[model samples]
Target: MTLTKKILLGMFLGIIVGIFLNLVTPQAYPTIETYILSPVGKIFISLIKLLVVPIVIVSIILGTAGISDPKKLGRIGTKTIVFFLTTTAIALTLAIGLATLFQPGVGNFQLEGAQFEGKEAPPIVDTLLNIVPTNPFEAMTEGNMLQVIFFSILVGFAISQLQGRVKLVVDFLDQANDILMFLVGVIMKLAPYGAFALIAVAIGGQGIDAILAMAKYFGIVLLALFAHLVITYGSAVAMFGKTNPITFIKNFSPALAVAFSTSSSSATLPVSMDVAQKKLNIPKSISGFVQPLGATINMDGTAIMQGVATIFIAQVYAVDLSMGDLLTVVLTATLASIGTAGVPGVGLIMLSMVLTSIGLPVEAIGLILGVDRLLDMTRTAVNITGDATCALMIAKGEERHAESYSEAIAES
Candidate 1:
């Protein structure tokens, strides 16, 4: 079977097993999860994580070195950040608009006994400042993505400047890039089993009741995510990248499946980069630079959740959100994407920040917490799609720029 087909099979079987465990043999869940699912899932995730830092560093350096122009790098960086932030803002707005129209929170909900305490997001200023690492090695150890990105770009820039002198270093990075990509291919062979175990654990742990109770809210979130993927990303890829939307989606399905299984853009980075480079024909420099940065800061999926959750929570609590408040949600969630980047359970934390911004009860987050995991999987797929879209668009733009420059020189 093709890899995508294998992944789909794993997901299908996982859903069946998960449902069976949840409904039929709830008692066996603990033992099954402990021995069978968790270990398999964690091992898969660990293997992927093991490669993330090194891959990001090596890929970024190679990508930037290829560009060899600070001005062009700056332009790509500007376009990438703009694309991420803009799409994220649009995602939040769509979620809020849909939630408001559907009124997912209008029905009866038991908010009295619900309790949830969110982790505090660090200040935006601090997040921005922290991008420049004090020690690049420490950043690599901790997997501080922004810091690592900053350091790698600098190394690439330096190599570009000293091209003749640093031929040995550049060649080494090029070879290292090849080796890491080979390892990525090796690791991906295990995705089916890993995806199965991960999905099984998620479904088995999250019982059906939570999903049923919040069906309306859940449905709205899914609809919004679908719309964003089809409308926003589909349009961008077709118009900017000059690629067929269906072709892009088809080639990118493997990464999407892994993203769905892991529910982490970071964990799925290796697979995503590979798909972009090999399948989509995105250059390493563009893929490496755009995707790693996107995984860290571009969170359209998380923003959608925050938007819908904020509106849903308000409705449940009978709190009326003014136009100004809705705008605040858009702005807060958009900026919070960057502020909360790389933090675990970031969706919930950012939702809390949005709620707190408008004086909503933070505890109301518990209302949707139960089904969040399922939605998280879907939204993660959406998140990485946005990342790939940006990478493809930027790659196409760079290609055109290089071609135009060559033609102009030829004429001169």
Candidate 2:
């Protein structure tokens, strides 16, 4: 079977096993999860994560080095950032708007005595300042992606300037890039089993009650995600990249499945980059530059969840959000995507920031915590889709711009 087909079968079997464990033999869950499911899933994720830092550093260096002109690099950077921010803002607005219309939290909900301690989000200033790494080695060891990206880009740019002097370094990185990609291919052979274990654990542990209880909230989030994927990303790909939307999604399915299974954009980085370059025909230069940056900053899926959850929480507590308050949610969630980037359980952490911004009780998060894992899987898929869309569009634009520049030169 093709990899995508194998993955789908794994997901299917996982759901069946998960439901069986949840309902038929609940007692066996602990033993099975502890011994079988957890280990398999963690091993798979660890293997993928093991490659993430090196892939990011190598891909970004190779990407930047390929773009010999600094001005062109800056142009791509500007376009990429703009696309991510705009798409994120739109995602938040869509989530909030849907939640308001659906009123997912209108029914009776137990809000009293619920407890959830949220991690504090660092100040915006600190997040910005921390981007420039004082020690690149420490940043890589700690998996500080933004700093690694910064340092890699600088090294790539320096190599571009002194091409003759750094010929050996450039050739070495190119070879390293090939080796890393080959490793990714080998790791992906294990995705089917990995996906099965991860999904089984998630569904088995959470059970069905949590899903039924927050059915409205879950449905709303899914609807908004679907709309954004089809309308926002589909339109961008079709209009900007001038590619058929169905072709784009079909070609990108392997990476999306891994993203869905892993639920970590960073962990799925290698697969996504590979698909973009090989399947989607995105240039490595743009794919390397845009995707790593997007994984860190462009969190449209998580932003949507925060938007819907905020409204849902407010409704459950009998609190009314005014137009101004809704506006605050859009801004806070949008900015929090960047400010809280790379933190663990970042979706919930960013949600806490949004709640604190509008004086909502952070403890109310416990209400939806039960089902966040399932929703998290879907959102991660959406997040990387947005990243790939940005990369493809940027590449197409660069191609057109280059053609135009060549034409102008010929005319001159």
Candidate 3:
């Protein structure tokens, strides 16, 4: 079967196996998870991890080298960021609207002082500070994605400044990107095994009681996410790209699949870049800047989750939020999601921030922690969709910008 079919099959089998393990051989499930499943999942992750730095380096190098005009780079960066922020803001608003309308959090979910520990999210200025690494090697070693992006872009920019002498470097980098793409393709083939093992182990561990307890909340969060994907992403494509939403979805699926499986927008960057440029026909210059920045900020899915989840948790704890408080959540989550770096597990961290902002007990985080991974997969898919959507919109805008520039020149 093809990779996509295999992945779907694996997800199906994983759910079945997990349910069976939960019911029948519960004791043995841990052994299976520890020995067979976890290892496979880790192996899959390792392969992706191995590719991340090289992919970032080479892709940024290629993107920069392709930009003969440095002026275009600044313009591209500004436009990309503006588009990302706007979409992210809208995504948060949608999430909050749906959550409030659905009342997803209005039941008995005890708050019981849930612990929500996370790295202190730096201020926006400090976030900017973190982008430029003091040591590039240190950045890679720590797997600091934004820093890697910053350093790689600098490397690419510097390469661009060289007068024809750096053509060999650019050529070599092109070969490197090809090899990384091949490795990504190979790693994707192993997705079924990884997905199956990880899912089975996770579900088996979570148990049915937890699922039942959070069913309503789960449904609400999921529904909100679905709405954001269909409504927000679909509208963006229909209005901006002037393309059929279904066709856009079809083109976006491969990258979405990768993002779903990995649950890390940064990790999914290479594949996203490839699909955007190759399948969607977004220009290399556009995809390069937008995709990376999207990985950092355009977390529509996570924003949706934060919205529904916050309301769900509040309702469970019987905390009656004022309309003002709900709006506070909407605004904070929206801004926080936009500001959040699109790395794996950062959703939970951002969620924690949202909880703190609204005076919800952090301990409530433990309640959703079990299902967080599963939810994260879906959210990552949503995040990628938003990213891809923004890329297309910005590409369309850039085309318009160029047309305007050309017309102005002709008029002059």
Candidate 4:
């Protein structure tokens, strides 16, 4: 079977098992989900974690070295950052608009103090400084993908200036990357076990009671995610890239699928870069730099969730947000996205920032935390979609030809 078919089946079966586990009494299915099923999920995520640093380091190194002209590389980087920022702004705006319309949190549901602790978000200037690595080796060991990407591009650019060294380093990394990619392929073959395990454990442990309790809010977020994917990303493809929408979607599916299951833009970074650089035929320099940055900062999906969620919370608490307050939510959420890039448990904390900006109660954030993980997964999928979309757009702008990245299955 095709990888896509296998992945799709894995997703389907995982969800089914999760739902079934939820339906069964804990006494009946307890041993299975907790022991066998849950471990599979943990292992799958562990595999992703295992591959994350090496895959990113290798891909970025190879990608940057491929650029013959360092000037073109700079241009690509500028174009990509601009595209990511623009799309992120648009995504936040769309989320606000849809959230205002749907008001996902406006329902009869009791909320408790949620378990959300936020790490510090550095000043914007400081954050930018952090992007430049002081020690590349330490960054890789720590899984500091941003620093790794920055150093990779620099190393690649330096190598470009040396003809003999460029060829030698590029060829070496190219071979190493091929081996790492092969490992990824091997891991993928074990996806079914991972998917089933992860989903069953998450579902069985969380249970449907949690999902059903906030059904309206959950549904609204999902609806907004669909709209954002179809309208925002799709429109960009149609207008800028001049690619067929269905074709773009087909090409982007593998990355999106992995993003959805993982619910982490960072974890999904390697796959997205691969699809963009290899499958889509976008240059490595563009894909490598842009995908990693997008994982860190360009969170269209999270922005949308915050947008809808803020409004939903306001409506639920009967907190009459003035026009000024609504605008505050939009601007705050957008800025918070950039500010909280590396902060842990940022979703709720960012929401709290938005609420405080509008003089709303911080407690309202608790209302949505129950379904946040599920929503987080959906948003991540859309965010990566936007990343790929931007990569294609920049590729077109650079007069770089982009082939369908989804052709990996065919090549395999």
Which is the leading candidate under lDDT?
Answer: 2
- TM-score (C-alpha) between model 2 and the true structure: 0.99
TM-score of model number 1: 0.98
* Predicted structure 2: clash tally: 0
**Residue-level lDDT tens digits of model 3 in 20-102:** 99999998988988889789877876777688777777777677667757887887778677766676667667766776777
Put the candidates in TM-score order, highest first: 2, 1, 3, 4
Residues 1-412 of candidate 1: C-alpha lDDT, one tens digit per residue = 9999999999999999999999999999999999999999999999999999999999888888887878998999999999999999999999999999999999889878788988989999999999999999999998889899999999988888988998999889889888988988898899999999999988899978778998999999999999999999999999999999999999999999999999989999999999999999998889988999899999999899999999999999899999999999999999999998878788999999999999999999988888999999999999999999999999898889989999999999
How much is 360 displaced in model 2, in angstroms?
0.9
Candidate 2 clashing pairs, residues 3+ apart or interchain: none
Kindly list the per-residue Cα lDDT of model 4 for residues 96-201, writing each as its tens digit. Answer: 6776776666667665554344444566667667989888899888876667778877777777678684576777888887887777777777766665566556
| TM-scores for every predicted model | 0.98, 0.99, 0.91, 0.90
Candidate ranking (lDDT, best to worst): 2, 1, 3, 4
Off by over 4 Å in 1: 410-412
Candidate that beats the other on lDDT, 1 or 2, i.e. the better one: 2
Error of 1 at 214 (Å): 0.9
CA lDDT for candidate 4: 0.74
> Using TM-score as the measure, which candidate wins?
2
Candidate 4: clashing pairs of residues: 41-198, 105-312, 279-405, 280-405
Error of 2 at 357 (Å): 0.9
User: How many steric clashes between backbone atoms does each model show?
Assistant: 1, 0, 8, 4
Give the per-residue lDDT of model 2 (tens digit) for 95-127: 998999999999988878568999999887799
